[model samples]
Target: MTKRIQHWLAMLVTTFMLTLSVSAVASNETSANSDNERLGESVVRQEITGFAGADYWRMVKDGQEGYTTSKSPEHGVLISVPGQTWYILKEKWMSPLGALAIFGSLAMVALAYVVVGPLKLSKPKTGRKIKRWSRFDRALHWSMAFTFLTLAFSGLTLVYGKHFIKPVVPTEVWGWIIYAAKQYHNYMGPIFGILLVAVLVKWWRKSLFTMVDIKWFMKMGGMVGKHKGTHPSAGFSNGGEKAIFWLLIFFGIAITISGLVLDFPIFDQTRRDMELSNLLHMFSALILICGFIFHIYIGLFGMEAALDGMITGEVDETWAKEHHDLWYNEVKDLPENQPGYDAAQEADKKGSASQNNA
Candidate 1:
């Protein structure tokens, strides 16, 4: 019985050792097969994908059509060279140029104010007033003024708010502010356009250039040195006023047209048209802004009693005589000092002489 038990134990031990060796060999072969399959798959992937540099992007940029559900023709374009070029111009060039133009005008005005001082009246106020602007005139002036300023502020916020305002304000507040500015600008643009046309039409006759304007230009409207005491003869509008009017007419028209192009996209205008219009709108507005800086300065503080004309629809007789002698001559008798109105007498004599000659 002992010998039979020993023989069975030996057989079982040998069988167990053989089984372990066979399993090890099978495991090694399986691992090697897996590695070979992995290598093959990698090679196939490389062959299918081609090179991963310029060729890849080149295919994408060569007017490749992308899948989309939209029926619009432009929707399928994967890349647009014109659009990319416009983006670069707006970001890298237009934005910076606009900033410089605006700030440069401000600095120039400031320097002039410091060096030249206010253009003061050489004579004393007579305490008498003559009508300078009519009620309709004052209404139109103020309407245009306020509307233009609103547009300017909101438009500037759109352009520069991200760079200057975003860092200083809370993110939530900044987002709201920008959103509000855009809304204000979009709504007010058409209003400004209407008012501008009115202003140009109403002031056209008075703003016509004449030979007398040449002399006013030579004297710099008596705003320069040694000429400060010399009150150059001027009509209803001086040479400077004519220049401002023309600037407003041209630039204002350009701004209005371009703004309309952007405001209403229903005209089926192309992306290229919109891009060009935006460029024209922004740059034209920048130029107009420079002119506005001068206009605001003169109307508010640069010239004494200037705002009075626009605010009250009248000016003092002395103020009129100093700034606009020719216009004063026409309306001099309309003031309170009319009892001794010698201007009307002089005008009658001149009129009689001209009539006789005719």
Candidate 2:
């Protein structure tokens, strides 16, 4: 009986102690929560940053959306990196500017048919004239000129081939053609570079922009043909032509250099660097093509008398007298410029005289 009583008492004492211990633990936990509310969370932010790397942190104080990263005891300073968007521009129901440039170019070409009639002249001049270019000079000019034309057409086909022309070309063949076009385009790029250098060397003297050029620029070269007065009187080339020429020179070099970087992989270039080159090359080409389109116009339908300058190296007598008075005067001084002279210069005069007299 004594032993049983002793065992019961010991079990009762052990149960009471365990109950007190558990209650104390619960009370401590509750107190910790209360303390947390008062202490306002020990953010204790730790920041980690490095060169060319993201900023990292623990318990960083940050703002939402545009306003990010604030400073607090718990949160540390935060930095931001910019983000880009991928939205497409819309025009006439939404279109890219590239499509616009293309569409506008086509429209201009079509309009040429309406604006420029058969190569007929208005008022013919029977007077003597000057000689501007020789047969050799013309040969060089036409070679590069035709080369550029071929390259432009092929290049356009390559640039907009898939979007505009793929519907007509068979899929398999189109793929092959595009591949071939790219190959040829790149191959001929160096050729263009060579031609561009030659042209620069050939015309650098005449192409220099002078203070006189400022007057020309302000007057828009006085080339107001569609309106009232006639095109501006010019020497060898006009201000606008000079601008286009210089652009071609700079952009030609740029196109060549960037193209080479991509073609040869000469530098241990990074992918980003390569991507930049591609963008720059395309941008430069786009600008050149835009200028070139106008050049083609002025060379062809836009002007009544300028086309022969490149094709046959001479213009009608009256055409020269009217548009290129200064140049005509210079050539008139040259014995080679005398009419019935039997030279190409004289032959050009005869051809132009026929047209001008019409």
Candidate 3:
């Protein structure tokens, strides 16, 4: 009986071990099949969408030209890689720096006004006026001033208006404003170039640097600190004036050339040319804008009667003697510098004005 019991127990144990091995094999096979199915799905997906999509964008980014019906320059190229670089430079770097320069100039002028005050004449006015700018010179000066201010306004609006003006106005109003600014900028650009050239021709000789100008600059034009009210001797164009003139000429020429390149694109300009022109235009314009801010401050508030010559084509005798003594002495004997010369010119001007009003 004991032997028969032992044989049955052995058979049962062997059968149980065989069943466990079969179950383990079946589970592993099922898991392997599931992994194979997933791998196949992944390969199919990659074949359908992954490689072609990446290649198309890579080619576009590389600026590879493709077949197209249009004959325009760069028309076959779907994306401009250089354009992205240009946008980053203009928007990220130039825009912020340009704004800082403009506002910093204004702040400095304001500080000067508060601390130093306007430069007043040391002596009383003589009541006798001397001719300085001619009628034609005054006309040209005013015309250029008007055109320049208009262009600056339009250009600034185009660059920064989206930040300030867009949010305040309705969509339709914003559209019109931007449209008008762009149109005005495009049309008036050439006019500014012509005026700039005219100014260079008219004033280049007077703007040349001289020894007296160097001395005048050393004295800070007698308007600051220990030199206050000193009334330093100067020629017809002082050091400061000469600096402003040359600055305008140099940057004005740059602005004009770059502006022309952007304004007229018919010469088959590549994308690179336009991008470079844009950077040059913005750099030149920002510098001039900052410089003119100081110039405007001096004319309007920094000095007494500084604007008289530009406005009336004459300045008081005391002004000429104090601010430009060398020039005063040179021209003192001229007919136009005589005591009653301004009265005679005024009479003639009144007659011309009356006729025009009629």
Candidate 4:
């Protein structure tokens, strides 16, 4: 009986100790809450009073002066509101649209090719050839092409590399790639700009739009199946070629000017000026790239015998007559070894010999 009583007493003592421990935990929680409430009160008061203080965020918001060793005006800026806005626009708006402009242009070109196929020649290739682009013209064209392509690819790397390439490449390799792209873009931009200006000046007369060009456009420049027989009046350049030329001229100017503003920061352009320049640069580049897609499509594969004019600086007599009759008529009766001259003489000799036989 004494042992049973001792056991019941031990159980009750154990339950009492557990209850005391729970109460102690609850008490500690309550104390912590009170301390947190006190801390919150102090924090709230500090936050409420902090805005009124001159040093709180005045310097940040107002873009007050700070100390920096860099010579750039933007270096010491604590907080640039315009810069922040520019960043948001660049990241959120321009980048996505730029990507769309490029890829959308490419998609459209692909769709056009699939639907229309190549512009085939109605006549077979004649063995005789006629000069189209002179050697100097070819030299200038290739130089401009190289510079523009270099700038375009490098610029793409700078703009889209982080989002599109970073995930696939290692960080170190990506960094090196971006660095090289930046250097290439910066250096080639000026060369492209200069070459573009020179090319435009040299080819301005040939690219001038005329009533004949308007008619050519209406007839789809004999590229459509129904209009294949119609040789629309064209000079050295056809209507489509003129359009490409003008696109390059206008967009080249815009992109080059804006690129210059961004390239040489020593001009001391304001933050807003830099932002605007950047915006214009991106917009113009997008347009140029879109136009470039069409130019490449047509020059390379969209038309048969067209690439020969640029590559060998010559084209077949039939090809010239079919695509550019006006140009052929103008240069058809020159000296031997010249474009159109040999073909005209051959036709004349064959006709005279047949007349003598008759």
Which ranges in model 3 have alpha carbons more than 4 Å from their true place? 1-53, 69-71, 342-358
Please provide, for model 4 over 1-358, each residue's C-alpha lDDT reduced to its tens digit, 9 standing for 90 to 100: 9999999999999999999999999999999999999999988877856744557457657877677898876778868888888998888998998898888999988987998788888889976777788888899999998998888888888889888898999999998999999998988899998898899889999999999899999998877678865778787788988998998999899999999999998777878888999988988888888888989998898888888978888888888888888888787665543644666678899899999999
Candidate 4 displacement at residue 297 in angstroms? 0.7
Report lDDT (Cα) of residue 291, candidate 1: 95
| Residue pair clashes in candidate 4 | none
- Number of the predicted model whose TM-score against the real structure is largest: 3
Collision count of model 1: 0
lDDT of 2 at 141: 76
Worst-scoring 10-residue span by lDDT in model 2: 81-90
Off by over 4 Å in 2: 1-95, 108-122, 127-129, 225-227, 342-358
Where is the poorest 10-residue window by lDDT in model 1? 334-343
Candidate 2 residue-pair clash tally: 11
- Quantify all predictions' global Cα lDDT against the true fold: 0.88, 0.67, 0.91, 0.86
| Alpha-carbon TM-score of each model against the true structure | 0.77, 0.63, 0.80, 0.76
Candidate ranking under TM-score, highest first, comes to 3, 1, 4, 2
lDDT string for model 2 (1-358, tens) is: 9999999999999999999999999999999988977565433221223322242232232321223365322122232211011111112212246557756876876675576433334477565444567677787777777777677767777656777779997899998988888888878877887888888888899988776567666666555445224445677777787898899889878887887777776456644455556656766776777778877766777666676666666666787766656777777756666666676677798899999999
The Cα error of candidate 2 at residue 342, in Å, is 4.6
